[model samples]
Every structure is written in structure tokens, then in C-alpha cells.
Target: MSVSFRLGILGAVGVLAAGLAHAGWLWFAWVAPAGALDPGSAAASSWMPLLVQGSWTFVLAAAVGWQLQRSGQPLQQSLALLRQQVQALEQGRFVVVEDPPAAEALPLARSLNAAVRRLQSAIEEAPGQGAQALRRTARRDAATGLDSRFTFIARLTERLADRGGAQTALLALRLLPVQPGLAPDPRALAAAAEMLHLFSRRVPGAFVGRLCESDLALCLPAHDLVAESAHSLIAALGSGPERLHCVVGCADHLGGVSLGGALAQLDLATAEAEAAGVGALVCRTSHREEATPQEEGALRRQIVEALRANAMELAAFPVVDAQGDLLHLECPMRLRLSPGQPLAPAQAWLPVAMRYRLTTQIELAGIEMALAASARDGLSRCVHVAAESLSAAGFVSAVRSRLQATPQAAALLWIEIAEVSLERLPPRLRNAGTVWQRCGARVGIEHAGAALLSLVRLSELELDYVKVASDFVRGVAEHAVQRERVQGLVAFVHEMGARVIAEGVDEQADLDALWALGFDGATGRLAGRQGTAEALVAPGSDAAACRDQAMSPA
Candidate 1:
């Protein structure tokens, strides 16, 4: 029976017992003597039994009420404890509780504790998963699923550093027209990415990475020869349907060489590829002498100091239209001096800076120089960004902050990321582009008519202009097919709400051809040889007065 019913029954039983006892006592009194039935004695005898039974019933009710209150206390306490445990688990803390009430709360505590254990185990596994995710993130271009700049550099450096104990080589593929202006199609970029993926799969141990939007690096390990490996890679890339015409540079370590030396060799190979208009070119550098530990240490120190002091020189090339009107200047960076002497192209110092993880610093210096130059000249300027630097989340903020500090210079500042860098434009960069546009600055794409037609995707960026590769524009005059192709490209770019600038124009015919082809502007030897800021402007302009009078002649 329920507790209330049981208590009622017990109460009834107690009353019955008391009644029986009282009856017995009365019977005894009657049987005793007539004197026992006296008035005072009878009164006491009748009231005593009844009062005792009432007191017993009241005591039983009080005991039952107390027991009920005590039972509820355990339930309430258990619930409070469970809430606390769940809160702890949500906060990622897993600790065991002791001495829980065995009967009512033990099962709950065990279940909760088990859940906590599972949570702890999952939490423990998270770091490993996170680490793997970071590695994957580092290896692929964030935007296009192509290899990242860092992974590519590391693989190239490793291959170059490995002395020919086993044949090691690097294929540096530079998409022609590194500068902005050729409106690239997004489909071309995807096609290039697919082609690279296919090529990598065909060549064993060949790791492909996007060094920049305009460059791709492939490292071939265990190759029988460096030249052969480069050729094979080029052939594979050329055979692709996309027909990405790449300037391939190949380099190998003939003997023990520092990672820096290996990169230098790769740089040389890239130059060779640029010189040759083929799908690929290979240059092998045999280490002449083994670098001593002291030499390596000294080189490292030099690099550190150079990067810290921003000891680099910046040169600006004027971007002029077909009318010979100066529109903007493109700043390409060059290292002033290294441990040995001035490094030639960025390729020489860049790999080392990247290997030592100093690209961010270098990028900062480049931006600072470009901004300062823009401020002084009061002309719009375009600064190049490495693919790897673009991947860094803070890079945009750094550039924006620097630009903000120079209010007068912000409007004229234009930042151009290589086509390859676009493969991994971080969200921060994409957002930064909007911020930059709002600040009266424009964003442009460099090396437009090269591999990875997917550059068309950039149309969504609403960029100010697209610069086509000079080579594509150079001989258009001689080839009607080429001229028509460029015309169509310019038309497509215009449709995207962006203008086109042609590069590498060295002849009036070339300029005339581009003008006819509908290019917005042109730059190269024909536009004007590299000259001072003054020479870039019209004769009466302030910049023109600063031109070296002796060089210009009256």
C-alpha cells in the first residue's frame, strides 16, 4: 500500500490496541473492589487510557512526515550535482566525483562520469586532428585546392639541398606575364590546376605547389637525372588540354650544398626557362665548394640583418597607355645586398627568406617602400605580392595599417597579387580588397594571359584593371590570329567591368597592334626605357622636372 494508506492502517491498529488495554484495565478494576470504583479513581481510570492512545497516533504521523521530507532531499541534491557535472563537461573539464548516494544517485553518477570520460577522450584526440588539419591547410592553396607556396618552397629547397646521393631536381614553372594586365579567365586557372594535379600524379615523388599565382614549383626526387626529370615534367604539363605554356627552370644539387645554394640553383633555372619560350627549361648547378658551418651561420646572420633593416631597393616601372600617358607605376622589388653581394632577382633572396620564415618581414618592407614611393611621387602604384605572403592571415591587416598611416598615399596605392597567389587568397585578403577599394585604392591582377584561366573568377572581385602579358601582346602585329585572340580577351575583360593594360611592348607597331586590339594601355621598352619618376610624367608635370636632365637631353 502507499505510504499514506499504510500510516493510516497503523494508526487504526494503535487505536484498537489502546482500546483493548483500556477494556482490560476497566474489567480488572470492576473485579477488584467496589472501593476502586470511587468517584476520583473512576475519573482518572477513564481519561488515562484515552489520552495515551491519542498521543501514540500523533507520534506516528510526525514520524511519517519527517521521513517524506528526508527522502526528497536526496533527490534534490542528486539533481543539483548532475547539473554541476554537466556544466563542467561542457567546459571541457573531466573529473570524477566520490561518495555519491549509492542507492538513488549511483547509476546517474556512473553514466555522467562515463560521458565525461568519452568527452575527455574526444578532446584529447582533437589536437592530433587539429595538427593534421593545419598540415593540410599549409600544403594546399586555400582558395583553389592547389599546392601552397610554403609546401612548394620546402620541397624545392629539400631537393636542391640533397646532394646527388640520389638524383634530386626541381622544376620551377613560371606562368608568363608575371605582371598585371592580361585578364585571366578563371577556367584557365582551374585547367592549370587540374593539369598540374595530373602531372604530379604521373611523376612519382613530384610534389607540386603554387609558389605564386604566376608560378608553380615541382620537386622530383630519386630521378636518374635533373635534365630528364625537368623535360618529363614539362612534357606532361604541355600535353595537358589546357596547353599551359610554362617557363620551366630545372636545377639539381651535384654535391653537398646548403639549402640556400640549392634555391639559388633553382633561381638560375627559372631564369633559363624565362629566356627560352618553351614549356620547360632545365639548368643544373653543381656545388663548387661545400659551405662550412661558419659560412652558413654567417649567411644566416646576414639575411637576418638585411631583413630587419629592410635593406632592399625598390624599382618602379611606369605603366603607360598607348597614348604614352602615364597611368601608374609597378614596383618590383630587388635585394640591395646579401652576404656576398646584391641579389639579382627576388627569386634569389625569396627562397631563402621563405626557408628561414622571413617572408612576412620582407613583404612589410616592400609595402613600406612602395607606399613611401607612392607618397613622394603622388602617382598610383602597384606592388607585387608573393603567393606565400598572401596566405598569411595578418598580411592584409599589415598592408592596410601601413596604408592608413599615410593618408595622402592611400589613394594612389594599388596592390597586385600574382595569378598564382590568387589560388589561395585568404578571406582576410578578399575582405581587404573591399577595404582597399573603399579607401580609394585599386586592386589588379598580374600576368593575366597565362596559365590557370580561372583568373576569370577574379571578375567577381570587381578589380580596377587587368594587365595582359607583354609577350602575348608583343608579336600580335605579325600574327592576325594572335591579335584577334588578344582583342577577344580585352573584350571579355571589359565585359567583366575591368580594363586591360598590355606589358612588354617594345615597338610602335606592337603598341599600335595592342591599341587596335583594344588594350587600355601598354608598358615596355617601347613605352619608354626604365627612367626616373620625373620621366614617367608629361614634360610640364612636377615628376618630369625631376628626370635626370642629362639623360633626357633638351
Candidate 2:
């Protein structure tokens, strides 16, 4: 109990003992002796001794009890301090007591401090771990480990967004022997996934995914031997015990074709394959007359020569902050094969570059060009690095050495990897981002939000900023739901300790809405341009109209 109460109890016990001793002495030495002898002698001799012994005994016991209680006070105080620290920890405050009141609690305090440190470390690594888990559970088929339909579609759309769909080849496969209205057999699906996974290994940079209940698809660089891969896939399907039949259709992404248009072409090819019969394969070329082998070789040689000659120019665009101040210049490479030929945007030639395995070399060259321009212009510039290049061997080291060589230019550089690619190489990106940052450059993800859950782990990538894809930002000005999403995304990115930027701000109204929603910066036709005299949410504008419509339901 308390020191005061314990001491009081001890004092009472001492007083009782002292009283008992006094009573005994009185009976034997005072009362009994006085009755048999002279009263005055007995009283005079016993009274003084009795008073001295009782007083000394009571005082001595009380003094010793008080000392013991005082000695325990430090320990009691130390326990209270520990309790406070533990409460703080429970409340998410990692406070520790320095110099605990008593040495008895020193070891416990050290242990508590160590626990706090460990928890902090786990929290720091949690985002990346959580991101990976999300990709597995949310983005992939549970059994197949292939991207979910929605995730696959998003990635396809992103890839196709580039010019000529980056010359991608779409291979669609339909498993046969399906009962009408019934789902495809899981065994067949799993077997198909396994076959596709193995076949993909033979095709570099090939991506496979389950697109429908009985249909699966793979996309790769168009220059790959699509017909041969399809044949191999069909043969593998027939080798199984069930002799499962499959129809394979291959379509090359043609320039100027929309995603829907490309899918339509793929569907036509699949229909043709099915009509040809089960286990049949059909191929659709981009042109009515496919290029000959010599023509293909000539184009490849030209690209190689162009790369060797370093015949590309960079087109810089401004990404600006909320106040319309320039944040950086996005310098995308524009290839010019000959002095007479006009510059071609990356979309026009990237597919060819990818086909020739020249992306790594081309991207590296672009980085060098951007850095040189940054040095000369003294302006901050951003360069987009494709996922292919990032995974290419020696790419990171080459960029690191180049950045190190031009420290000043590196400091002014911003390197971005696509969001779709980010999902594929977080660990590599994590290391690369740190190296780039240390070399005075910043790394980030562009075209983000394809996989919403993956954004939660942005901190794991250690990026400087995240650029939200235009699809999400397109009509946020007129859609209340979109505005809410953008706002939440901005807050989430901020919590992850990275700025959020809006890409493809085509309309002034959209840009205004983004600015109000707390976007840190943005790029597009409308960004970096002066705002109109009217308020951001002007009357009769889409933003105001949307607000009114949302409140109308009330």
C-alpha cells in the first residue's frame, strides 16, 4: 500500500508492544512491589525506567518503518513513469522515459525503447509489403497469378495510349469444348495459364492475362514471330490428356487505330481462326501487304544507324505548380532518322525501337540528351523511362554513372517510370530510385492509378511525385464522384510523402477543379497557362453545375 499508511500501521504495532511492556513492569515492579514493600521506592525506581524503555521502543520502531517506506518511494515513482510511457505507446506516441526514477526499472526502459525502434522499422517497410500483397490479391487471378481482367485492360489501354500501340501484337486464345451458359472448367483454365506462362518465357517482354471466362490473351512486341508462338501454344494445348483444343488469333497494332479498333481487329482474327476450325490459328497484319523480310531488315538497320548517329531531338513541355509557375520541363525524345525527314514523336517509333531491342539504348541516349540540355539550359527537366529499359541489364548502373558524371545536371533531372511498370519492378525501382536520388536526381511514377490499390504503397517506391492518369482527371470538373476521388487521391499521396500531379489537363475547367482539390502540380495543354478572370468555380460552369446537381438529390 502507500508508504504513509504502512508506516502508520507499523507505528501502531510498536506502540502496542511498548504499552504491553509498560503494563508488565507496572504490575511486577511498581504495583506488586509497592504492596509488599515501601511504595515510594518502588515508584521512584520503576517510573523512570519504564518511561525511558517505552518511549525509546516506540520511537525506534516508528523511525525504522518511516525509513523503509521512504526507500520504496523511488520504486513506486519509477513504476508510475513506466506506466505513463506505456500509455503513450498505446496512444501511438513512441515516447520513452529517460532516466527512470529508480535504477530498478532501467532494464525495462531499454527494452521498451528497443520495441519502439523495431515497430518504426516495420512501419517503414510495410507500404512496400502491403503493395505487393495488394497486387497478388486484388490485381491477379487467384489461381492463375495472371492479371485480373480489369487490371489487364487498364495496362493494355495504357500501352496502347502510346503511338502505334508501341507496335504491340495482341494474341487472343479461346479454349474449346465449353458447354453453353456454363463457366469454363477451372482445370482447363489453370492448364491454359500454365501453358501461356511457359510459352511467354520464349517470347521476351511478353505479357499474358486472362481476359474472359474461356479466353486468354498475350501482348508482345509485334516483331516477334506471332504465328509460330500461336502454333506452339496450340500444340501444347493438344498435348494434354483431354486434348483440349484452342483457337488462336494474332493482330498487329496498326498506327492510328484506337484501343477499341485494335480489339475489334483481334476479334475478327479470332472469328476467322474459329471458322477455320478448332485448333486453328489466324494472323492479321497491320497492312494489307505485310512488309518483306528485306524491308524489315532495312527499317531495323535505319533505326540502328539513327541511334548510332544520335539523331533525335527532345521536345520540352512545362509542368507547372498551382500558381502556374514552372515546376519542370518534360523533354520527350523525338527521333529524326535523316536530316531531311521531320522529327517523329516517340509514339511513332517506340514500337519499332522495342521490336529491335533498342529501347534500352534509345532511352539511355534520351537520358544523356536530357542531362546535356539541363546543363545548357539550366532548367529542371523530366524524362520518362520505359519499364523495358528499367529492367534491361546495366541500365541502372549506366544512368548512375552518367548522373555522377554531371552532378549539377542530375540535380535538375526528374526520371519517371510508368505505373504499369512500377507494379512489375518495385524492388529494382526501390534501389534505382535511391541511387538516382543520391546522384542528385529524383524518381517518380507517371500515368498512375491503373491499379488503385498499388498506389497505397507509393511510399515503398520512394518517389518524389505521382502523376495521376488523365482518365481519372478528365472530367473531374463535371463529376462530383470524380472530384471526391481526386481529392482523396491527393490526400493519400500527400500522406505517402510525395506530391501528386495531374496529367493531361486538356480543359481549363478540369485544371481549375484539380487546383481546388489540392494538386501539387500538373502537365497538359491547359496547365502553365494563365487562368481566366472568373473564379475557379464560375457560375454556369460545369463545376458549379455539377455541385448543384449533386445537391439536387438532397
Considering every candidate listed, which one attains the maximal TM-score?
2
Which lDDT tens digits does candidate 1 get at residues 1-554? Answer: 45645675677567755554544445453543445444366543665566576566756765785687668777777777777775553332456565365367877677656544443443234322222232333456765576665455444434433323345556676766434465334565566666667767876877777655566666666534657756766677677666665677776642333333344456556867677774658676543234576765665577678766667766556777656677787665666556567543453444345546566777678778877887886777777665556666787777778877887787888776544345445544654577767666788775555431233335457778887654346566765434544555676577567778886565777778778767886665555533343376343322221111101100
- Model 1: residues with Cα > 4 Å off, grouped in runs: 1-298, 338-344, 426-428, 506-508, 530-554
lDDT per residue as tens, model 2, 180-218 = 556667788888888887777777767888765567888
Among all windows of 10 consecutive residues in model 2, the one with the lowest summed lDDT is: 545-554
> How well does model 1 score by local distance difference test?
0.58
TM-score of 1: 0.48
**Which candidate comes out best when scored by lDDT?**
2
For candidate 2, give the lDDT. 0.66
* Model 1 alpha-carbon miss at residue 338, Å: 4.8
User: Cα RMSD to native, each candidate?
Assistant: 21.6, 21.0
C-alpha lDDT of all candidate models, in order = 0.58, 0.66
